[model samples]
Target: MEERVWTGWNPRLTTVFSVAKTSTSLQALEAELNSSIACEIEYASVYFFMPETCKKNIPVLVKTASTPYLVVYKSGIPVLNTPILCDTLTDNGDWIVIQRRTSGDVDFFKEWVH
Candidate 1:
């Protein structure tokens, strides 16, 4: 699959698309991402030290500016919205931005990626 999709722990929650799969539509991509997020959330509390719902309520401050938080990312998303991902550094307090590298990045889809 040319589409680079990964769901696992690499210091933080990460899911990325290595290459776009023309065969898959955007809807399909979102579904796949949701699956990844869901799987990670199920086990995230143990590593994040917060409950599934509690994670979002707590706004963390990261000096590094790049903290991978899957549970929190998913929480902010609405039940029905095409997820947007952007690979860049953003200065939004309590809100995180992601860079596009593919293999090792935290919350690569925290914002719209282009």
Candidate 2:
């Protein structure tokens, strides 16, 4: 198991979002994430439409904050996998998600290069 970090934001929803791989596979991860975000964020939606083409119909503005990383995980034995942290985003740091990308059916993140 491995992990990667993605940084981005949804302006319409006004939620700062990022994604990282947990010990468990994406099968249960999506369910867990949707369930949690629905409960935690007041009006936030985790609209993941095939990473690269996330809600293209809607628009978003990228913004960065300085606190609170909302990490959600599924129930499974974490294999202590070392996640591939994107160079664009930092551990527990604030960032905006420009777009989501999937490579060979594996979801990953990419940060906007300034």
Instruction: List the RMSD of every prediction in angstroms.
Output: 23.5, 28.5
lDDT of 1 by residue, 18-113 (tens): 234444577698999999999898567443553222223344332134533433333445682322332222442333344456677455457665
- Clashing residue pairs in candidate 1 are 4-18, 84-112, 85-111, 85-112, 85-113, 86-111, 86-112, 86-113
Measured with C-alpha atoms, the lDDT of residue 22 in candidate 2 is 36
Indicate the TM-score of model 1: 0.21
Give the C-alpha lDDT of model 1. Answer: 0.44
lDDT of 1 at 30: 90
lDDT of 2 by residue, 1-114 (tens): 122222232342333222323323575888899988877663333232112122222232331345222222211227633222121245433333333465567534556762
Residue ranges of candidate 1 with Cα displaced over 4 Å: 1-24, 50-114
How does each model score on lDDT?
A: 0.44, 0.36
Report residue 2 deviation for candidate 2 (angstroms): 35
